[model samples]
Target: MRAVIQRTFETALFVDGEEISRIPSGLTVFLAVCRGDTEVQADYFARKVARLRVFRDENDKMNRSILDAGGEILLVSQFSLAGTLGKGSGNRPDFGHAELPERARELYERVRDKLREEGLTVKTGVFGAHMYIEQKQDGPLSFIFEC
Candidate 1:
């Protein structure tokens, strides 16, 4: 499993130019599942995402977590993250490492439901659709995680 986590002051997803989901002082997660990844990886990733110290605290230090700040979240599936880097080595990008869409969706749903149960406001982009994200980044902070 892999995810690109961006800390934003605010963010929103649009579908057909209509906002479908939005968040404040939270994270926008672009998630990708690998062919061999299990639900346990999804569970671990979600917990780490919630506790990641990407937000600045009262001391102006990168110490506060999303959970600490009562932040919201928006998750979007992106299989491209699993693209093998062969194209740079004179071959086309190989996406065979990516999990099938059907399984990815199931794992994503598991992550979403688990996070939601923790009392965070969680939103999501439509699966398998082109998504537009408007992000107001308070700190212009971003990170990547893989497991």
Candidate 2:
């Protein structure tokens, strides 16, 4: 599994030109399930995302996890993250490494639910829908995780 995470003051998810979910202040996570990814990878990913200390603390140091910072999570599935670029590929994305949609959606939901079980509010985009995301990034901070 792979994820691109961003700290945001506000974030919203839109599909078919309709807003479906939003968060006040939290992390916007774009997640992808790669070929061979299993529940083990899902478990590791959820734990890491819950514990990642990207939020600033009292002294203005980046020492607080989202759990400590008190925020929600906007989880969006983005299979394209698993796409590969290389020679003889005609400059097109090769999704050969991305998990099939069925299993990928399962793992994506697992990650989302696990994060919620860790005590953070979690909102999600429609699984397979093309989504439009609007986010006011805090510190423009972003991080990537893979497992």
Candidate 3:
């Protein structure tokens, strides 16, 4: 599993120019399920996101997790994160590492459900839809989580 997490002041999703989900302030997560990824990996990412301390605390240090900062999550499924490039590969990207859509969706939903179970509001983009995202980043703060 691989994920790109960004801290945002606000984030919104649009499909076919129609507004979908939005979060006023929180994290926007772009998740990808790689071939051979399991439920255990999915669960691990969820727990990490819930407790990862990326928010500023009273000391102006990045010491607060989403659970302490009080915010929502905008989870997006992006299989391209599993694509391979470089070395033997040429300009064209190879998606052989990406999980098939069916299994990928299952693991994606598992992460979403687990996040909600952690007691934080969670929103999502349409699973297989082509979405346009608008995000106001809290900073240049972004992290990649993989396992």
Candidate 4:
């Protein structure tokens, strides 16, 4: 499982020109599930994201987790994150490492639910849908985690 986590001042998800989910002062997660990924990885990643200390503290230092900062999360499924480029003529991006849709959806939900269980407000984009995401990234801060 892979997650691209971005700290944001605000974020929203749009599908077919209509807003579906939104958050304020939080993190936006673009998650990808690789072949053979399991719920155990999902659970671990969810916990790690919640405890990641990317938020600034009273001392203006990056010392607060999303939980400590009282932030929300906007989770979006992004299979393309697993895309790979090969050598020579096969250099085009390939998604062979991505999990099938059914399994990927299941794992995505597990991560979303787990984060909610951790007492953080969580919003989500529609799984498998084409979406337009709008976000004002805080400090242009971002991180990538793989599990």
Q: Using TM-score, give the best candidate's number.
A: 3
Q: Write the per-residue lDDT of candidate 4 for residues 84-117, one digit (tens) a residue.
A: 8776538588898999999999999999999999
| Superposed Cα deviation of residue 117, candidate 1 (Å) | 1.9
Off by over 4 Å in 4: none
For model 3, where is the 10-residue window of minimal lDDT?
79-88
Each prediction's TM-score versus the true structure: 0.92, 0.97, 0.98, 0.97
lDDT for model 4, please: 0.94
Backbone collisions counted per model: 0, 0, 0, 0
Off by over 4 Å in 1: 87-91
The lDDT-based order of candidates, best leading, equals 3, 4, 2, 1
lDDT (Cα, 0-100) at 88 in candidate 4 = 52
Please give the CA lDDT of all the candidate structures. 0.87, 0.93, 0.95, 0.94
On the 0 to 100 scale, the lDDT of residue 99 in model 1 is: 92
Q: List candidate 3 stretches off by more than 4 Å.
A: none
Is candidate 1 or 3 superior in TM-score? Answer: 3
**What lDDT tens digits, residue by residue, belong to model 2 across residues 1-147?**
888999999999999999999999989999999999999889889989999999999999999999999999999999899988888788799989999999999999999889989998999999999999899999999998888
- RMSD in Å for model 4: 1.0
Q: Give lDDT for model 3.
A: 0.95
lDDT of 1 by residue, 1-147 (tens): 988899888898998898989887789999998998898998898888878888777888989888888889999888889887764545677888899999999998988988887777899999888888889976677888998
